[model samples]
Target: MDTQADRLAGAATGCPYPFHRPAPLEQPKELADLRAEPVVKVLLPSGDQAWMVTRYADVRALLADPRISRNLNRPGAARISKTNKLFQDPRMDPDPPEHTRIRRLVMKALTATRVERMRPRVQQIADELVADLVRQGPPADLNETLAYPLPIRVVCELLGVPVQDQQRFRVWTSSFKSISGSSEQNRLALDNYMRELIETKRKSPADDLISAMIAARDEDDGRLSEYELHWWSRLLVLVGYETTAVQIGGAIAMMLAHPDQFALVQEDPDLMKSAVEEILRWKLVGSSVTMLRYVTEDVEVGGVTIPAGSSIIPAADSANQDESVFEHPEVFDVTRKDNIHLTFSAGTHFCAGAALGRVELEVVLATLLRELPNLRLTVPVERIRRDEKHLLESFLEIPVTW
Candidate 1:
């Protein structure tokens, strides 16, 4: 009924929120002031304005708030990116009973138990990658050799994608996550590939997520639709591969950046769990900002009235950096016991693959520490190139030596 422009017609124009970093590993300077206000009107990259919620409590609360919806394809919703359709995809904004039903069936197939069973295979993958890295000699691009491949293979196996086809899948997923002009083309290619792969799985079923979903789609009750299966497959590969891949690269770089903290983990490999948690809490894994949630009704957040049909960004990165919730929030401590961060988000839309990501990170960290204790960055942390084009904030290359 109401447009975002109509809702903000008389409101004061706010400062442009800087989405790009002044430097790699540095939060945008505007974040400090924005977090103080908690809720403020700001301009987005797409030039549409929306409310940004940055305080930890407000963000955590708003994530679970029923008044907000992730269906950003709505007419009045703020666009996060001009070129990327990742958010605009209908699969990104599944409504009601459909969302509930799909999540239920997907969760059953992607349980913590199932992920735990994958640990040994995941660890073996890490070991093989590391051994290959050693043989390739010093000064290797860790992101290319290990970070990206480990999770790509893991996701391929989990989805029953053939080993020979993983490299193409990797290229397609990379394109799917990119914010560049070619992203749309790559997204369509990946979509077509998933559709064909689903058909292949339908004929020759296997013990994998795709096969499981196909069976669900064929049930007499018909719980999952053909549309849902294809989109779900694409979504899983994107989240399962790219998100974890970026986090793995970020986690290692974080440890390498803080030598003292890195030493603590190295001295006591038992601290890998805490280290991974701290990394998730500290690093802005996926993007400079989180996804947008369209307000379904007039809601008061942080003492500000956001009208219905408005767009709001719950800044999870800024939330994790809030000083009130975390004592000395800027300091990266590996052994911090009380660490609870919203990196994976909260409430009903919390990341489904969070457990699997954690396992991959833990296995990577522990295996590296044991096998290549001398692993260190070949270049300065600030010198590491950050991907400016992709929605995912990952390093262009993580050069390392053991």
Candidate 2:
């Protein structure tokens, strides 16, 4: 078996194909070039060779293949960084019966019907945030004013987290997402906090997702273990807000950057449905791959054989931009029909909160456009700063004036 370093040395002689995950708004040229290859060998931050599957068909196939497992604890699993190994979620890593059991327990709280029931509340939260932004006058940071707060408030309410404690949770969660030195430390702190919250829910259950999970029983009349409860709660609270927040920010930034499309949606509210879908398609919120899936057996993908235990990353960004699947893939057309983007990922690991995230985006975008029809960026697009440390790509601050 060739080591990742040996494979890299033997395969390509030139400088390792530079795989810089693009910034939030920037198109990833390196990924586009990688898509042309049968299978691109790229070095991870961990200095391990992982296959980057960039084509739409290949990524989809890779995701659906049972031979590829998301469990990072497996030997030879591809990791993004050393710190990432410290923060694995059981809900995300397990395969089959175990994963199925965990997903079923959690899905009871996040079903489409339950999420749709929260739509009015989501809209109310969005309206309030937009109203506050308007009251604050022009030159407001939408990222802070709307993007961050709306999702945070909604998720907290749904999870029974005290809205007053949001600021503290925000700080801890920010550190959890950071690529900085303190990320692990913050992750541990968040874990401890969630543990305490779980205990609280156990003793005094409320009508929230956490409490619902606390009382939920399986078909066999089994309850979630303490460990399962802790990790799932943490995953719910962190991902519940983090991903949706980024999408909201990305959608707004993309729309404001392209005023023509923005005006089109603003003129007719009915287009909001397509606009939301296109925004999800066009935006690159998450990483090139959500998590590294290790091959459990020899698997052929994209005309290349991935050996057992080798790590492979499915490039969702490249898949979204695949020419075969999307026409004029570069253009952010709101009217795209049959738009199928991998932003929320695909297959069994597809985001459980996707439906909720969509509703949140729809409400927020429609509310913002209606309330602030004249919204425009205060600074040049190039001047916008992005958080380089976090795994997800998004503007740190989006100052806009209406």
Candidate 3:
């Protein structure tokens, strides 16, 4: 298969800097070496250069820094992808006051209270998925049967989007987030689909998040613009399902690989909360680095002076494994205390759907542990393949049997 890595003419190597991982479950090899320097220049897949921060304190500090902006459309901002302008899109990264306003409306729409109320339904969904997987017998792809389907269904129901449209949603979202595909086309398709859904909800509303967001917009009158509503809806649908879905497969893989840690959770289900946190910390989605943030003014990161307009990648995955913050940072300890991973990020841009994502993951893991106690991977860890078509380092299939 001709991947982006293969096609890029002058893509740099050796630094192996950005998204290069030694194996499916391994962290990027350069992470430890990069941490020694703390901050260093690395070339991206797009053939653009940016500074990446690996230490926990530095990553957390960068995430919370007000001077660092998510709006990467600036003239001097480093391009994340040659084809995928998803990062560079203005609608995707709005300015402060507008960003603040959209976040406020989103909070009003997808409140923690509302997410908590869906706990029962979420659990039921997990139960049904497990039951179905069992009924279908063994040698099944766990990702297809469980991990991939669960979150999409949950998000679709939450947003009042049709669960029937899940297949199309999956394709659109995969393309939308793919580092290898035409990001602009996929993004437009997603945006158009979302706009149509919003219009449909406008005509005939339902008791769902989208409907609620629409109501919030109408009641406030320009507090949330039409474009903001559409953009937020599209983004929510994408992240709401994609990241959690990828995390489920990765988390399950991590647990199965370390039965001792899995045993801890099995022995005491109360450990599930911390276990989930550990999974979040340990899980590597794709690139350790997340969305690039352009500095608003001169900033000092890890003793290095970064001038205004320089792009920086705050590596939360690398931070989660920092030796300074986490003891035995290499080990996957389920009982590890104060497991403050930056998977959901920090500060103003913290994930809005985090609570809901947590609920889904907890339910999926707990239910699987209880119902499929003997579940084991049918293939060796290294034999498993990655879904390289998408940006996230997720499995193509997790073949498992009980």
Per-prediction count of colliding residue pairs? 0, 0, 1
| CA lDDT scores, all candidates in order | 0.80, 0.77, 0.80
The local distance difference test score of model 1 is 0.80
Q: Provide TM-scores for the models.
A: 0.92, 0.92, 0.92
Worst 10 residues of 2 by lDDT: 13-22
- Badly placed stretches (over 4 Å) of model 2 are 1-24, 86-93, 180-185
Summarize candidate 2's per-residue lDDT along 241-304 as a digit string, tens digits.
8778888888888889889999999888888888998888865575664556788999887567
Which pairs clash (backbone N, Cα, C closer than 3 Å) in model 1?
none
TM-score of 3: 0.92
Q: Write the per-residue lDDT of candidate 1 for residues 172-284, one digit (tens) a residue.
A: 77776665534566778888888899999989999998988776642434567788788788888989998889888988888888889888988988888988888998755
Put down candidate 3 lDDT per residue, 1-402, tens digits, no spaces.
Answer: 533323331234324346566777777655665677666666766777777787899889988788889988789787766767765666555557667777887889898889999999999999999999989898788899999899999998998888678677787788776666555666678788889999999899998998898888535535567887887787788788888888888888888888898898999999999999988887557775455788899999868898897888898877888999999988888999999888888888888988998898899999999999988888788777887656676778888888
> Worst 10-residue stretch by lDDT in candidate 3?
5-14
TM-score of 1: 0.92
True-vs-predicted CA distance for residue 184, candidate 3, Å? 6.1
